[model samples]
Target: MVLRPHGGEKVRLMVVGRKRLPDAERHERHWGFVEAIADSAKDLEKGLRAQSYGTRTRGERTQPAARPAGEGVYAVTLEDGQMHLSFALELPAKPGEVQKAFRIAPEASYALSIKNPEKGKPVNAGLREEDEADYPRRLQEEFRGRRFAREDVRLLDFEGAEFILIGARSNPEAEYGLDLDTHDEDYQHAEVIRRLRMVKSRHPIKPLFEGRWA
Candidate 1:
């Protein structure tokens, strides 16, 4: 199995299994499946970045690579016999909140997940029957109605959080990670496109995407 953590490397371990595990035992089965990582004491310490004190990008070799100091929301999952541990695509509900962005793995594709309706009942969230669901991937209020003096940054959001989204214009494999099934050609406004790139630039976009697709 592969452990895709925020650390600079992918920790791979092999788990021998009978190939058939009971469904009732699935949730509590993770602790039992861990194989011998054979990672040294120093290696384990560095994996968690126990020595990190301040935030540093992956290329900043001067210090350890780790998350920023704050309340970071993450999506941790173990699926298909591979453990996926990474920062999630998200926005802040309040001001002065920092979104956690970790290093981009050149080996992995960073896709966006733009929409999520009420996972709970509608009545619990005080929603009308016809109300459109929240576009979690959509950029609601970026920079909180503010922008830099010179940087013409655009922002958008998405949830095609994997290999499925090509993010291209009119391509069959391409998809926009938005609440509405949008495409690059369908976007009439340049401002919306600009904001999407801004959001992509934060953590793992740079040379890989350059914010061409949000």
Candidate 2:
């Protein structure tokens, strides 16, 4: 398997098939890869930074978004019984929280080194819909009316979690991973397009994409 780092949004695992597996199984395995990559990235970041005192003292080297088959990012190709996975570290394009941590005006990007597992990866599987559906309004209090930042980050995290949990509960042989079709295809595609447009719209910024058909 080959692992290449795309940029910062996600690690792409490309799975080519003589034949595509069942939808549920295929989705589960795909997410299994994402969880593996995300977990390794998290562990490595923590180990390298050492946040014993907790809070803001340690650097924030969090994993970026987890999306299946997108572009200008790393691609994991799975064909002929072999798998290739790619990894990349991404940051906000402009000066912001990430830049503050790096102590530069958002100009520098670093490579995050992490290890992988021989077998497949484990995913969060997440809390049930009933478990945290109420979180959004609650989280609003934390941000204290900072709508843009909250909308940008929290909405993606929470909605995606709910969707994952619902899928896990419904699918008996399922693993916790991202399956875009679990949500509305047309809407999800539009949303992804929006994100791509946002990234591309940045001044003097070039565009990146993967999994165009996906």
Candidate 3:
């Protein structure tokens, strides 16, 4: 991701060693995100809110869509500066289910209490000093820092369509003291909107431009 600050100068992100997700995995993830958003919108159109559960027909059971497993961190602003932390907990367990797990980027937490997040929801991540109480011996031995990123997967209305936007607080710009004036409420949101122009040509959603949320 490239960030153009106040001046016209651009600052490109450089990773030590970037690992690209396999073509198959990337396609699956892209489709998964698209399907999840479309499914929720379909339910909403029928006046049925599909958050925890879904609305089904006579004999068919509408199952909750499966999203990419693991944690997603997001930080967004609202009209009145209210912190809206939205989370969707899904339980996908059956006989023949596709369980593909992908680890992207450097996760914020120093250590995780739950060894496997693909199996269930986000548990007590031993990221805080107080979170030491969660572990039996890990806390007693090593010191865990309080700094950790909170994540969220939100459905953002792009143009007239909705898209799944994964947000995480542990962005490289913030970590490197580059994008530091974090007081602006819509800092992240604006940046995301601006960058959508670059993806308009290839992304399936075809996000044209930013518009008022309808």
Candidate 4:
């Protein structure tokens, strides 16, 4: 598995890692990881709203459509000043059912926490700290030396949740059709309208873009 920031700009911060889940039940555990992040971000945004200080003001939640079978990605944004912090997750199944774990760029020094059934656990992997000067060298060393990426699978009762804190990753990708510089009110207004519709619905429905504020 390889990890790189997407769109090749400042730091898109995307992880193209792989995992394995054979049946439908196993897949749901992975999905739960996505869900837990959404729920957690929502709760955080609400708290930010209540504080109304340097706290997050407007926010949006979105869950993109499922990618191919066993592939999922999620993103959330907290509108803070001129910058928005985006948190995202990507999950893909690999081969075998034996448990194996891999950590990518763990030493990059950002607040890291896990939100799963157990909740709030610190991830003490070697890569979680930020070694500023050696980052680029470290990234190449880790990726180049790997003869094969570790892919593990298991009957996971809980696949666990992945939580990431992010600053705006260089404006929305142009493909998303968002013009960040224009300051268009229509886009923001439309988002709010759509979110209202979703919130009013009684059923459990996932948005095309989850964890984004309207």
Candidate 5:
């Protein structure tokens, strides 16, 4: 994980992950960036989880949400004074669907950091030239219709929330896994692809993309 100051109030965080395989040549690597507001760390975590996982469950059954497998990294961004986190995953070209195999990881870890961007350097956000030019306009529009900036609002801060991290059982007798095939693969694939493309197309420009202040 790498963090560099984005614009005045945001940070650009890049997360890189690698999958180890018996064959060195077969190893896989994945990476993505999160542009998050430079606010509370708790907000950053919440934003990352939401952007990465989406709504917890879908359909009437309300199943346990799928989880990410392999190593993963994430960051946060602030849009219109509210922090937001975003990232992309490479899935089969199918739309709206993410493979179960893609979600479950045997082992993974993440690191978070914050720093100022390099001087006179530009970051590629994987946007087309035209899309890049229009990014500022889109950002302006996002906040234009809003009645209040998020910073102007105040909410009670609460403490004493309990958090836990649990590891899976190593013994086969104690380990359990679910194997359920209830949804149409084609539909799910299409849906996942559609949503991913939508996010990609938006291509909002981050302060980091434009370079940091001197």
Candidate 6:
């Protein structure tokens, strides 16, 4: 994935797949790897926090940890007074059911916890509004002149962070449900939106950039 900082410089984030380990081992190793990266980054720059995203299946279910996982992972750090992060994920065949998980930026999560220890509700109302407002433009840009449909898009408070879930299906005539074929443009669009939303929601204070950009 390509991430552009506030200054317009782009950085590419890549996920290295763990092919030898079983699901359980990979899950454990992934978080450890993330922590190591965050720690190393912090040595150079203090106050870096770990963040992540990933996909989970029913059989793959595991007890929740202090940090959560998704089909991907990220490390959020401070850069020139702005929060910066990178994305990485394993893109496997579309699971029978896609469960996107997110561990919000640590500092923000902690602040929310202190403010409402009982509820820890994410202050994402404004983010949701911005997403809805930008959906049409994002869809048009992603679809271009092609035909497609928004399969599913939702925002939920999960594990203390706001989870933005999005899916799309292309060639509307080909199937009545989400076209899981990863190579399909529609499926690609959905992935882009998923990642875009995650990054858009990352902020030290409030969420930034309301719209999706490839």
lDDT of each: 0.24, 0.25, 0.23, 0.23, 0.25, 0.24
Per-residue lDDT over 32-145 for candidate 1, one digit per residue giving the tens place of the 0 to 100 score: 122223232223223433243434555433343332211122233323332323232212222122211222211122122211232323354323434432333334332233
Cα displacement (Å) at residue 106, model 3: 9.2
lDDT by residue for model 5 (1-214), tens: 2132222323222232332111112223233223333343323433333233335465244333212221112223333444322222222222122222233222222211111111111365332333221223433343345432222111101111111112222221222222211233332343322232323223221211121224
What TM-scores do the predictions have? 0.16, 0.19, 0.19, 0.19, 0.20, 0.18
The local distance difference test score of model 5 is: 0.25
Question: 63-182 in candidate 6: lDDT tens per residue?
Answer: 322111223333333333322222333332222112212221111100000011222234743123322222334433532333221221110011121222111111221322222222
Residue 176 accuracy (lDDT) in model 3: 28
Instruction: Tell how far residue 45 is off in model 6, in angstroms.
Output: 31
Model 3: per-residue lDDT, tens digit, 1-214?
1112334232222111122211221222110111112222222222211234435655545443222222223223331322222211111111012222222333211111111111222354212332121333432222223222122112121111111122323333433223233322232344423332322222312111221123
On residues 102-158, what C-alpha lDDT tens digit does candidate 2 reach at each position? 222211111111111111123654333344323445544543443222122232223
Worst 10 residues of 1 by lDDT: 148-157
Instruction: Name the candidate, 1 or 5, with the larger TM-score value.
Output: 5
Model 5's TM-score against the true structure: 0.20
User: Please, what's the RMSD in Å of model 3?
Assistant: 19.4
Cα displacement (angstroms), candidate 4, residue 52, comes to 26
**Per-prediction tally of clashes:** 17, 15, 7, 25, 25, 7
Off by over 4 Å in 2: 1-55, 60-125, 128-131, 134-197, 201-214
Residue 206's lDDT within candidate 5 is 23
In candidate 6, which residue ranges exceed 4 Å CA deviation? 19-27, 31-75, 78-96, 99-214
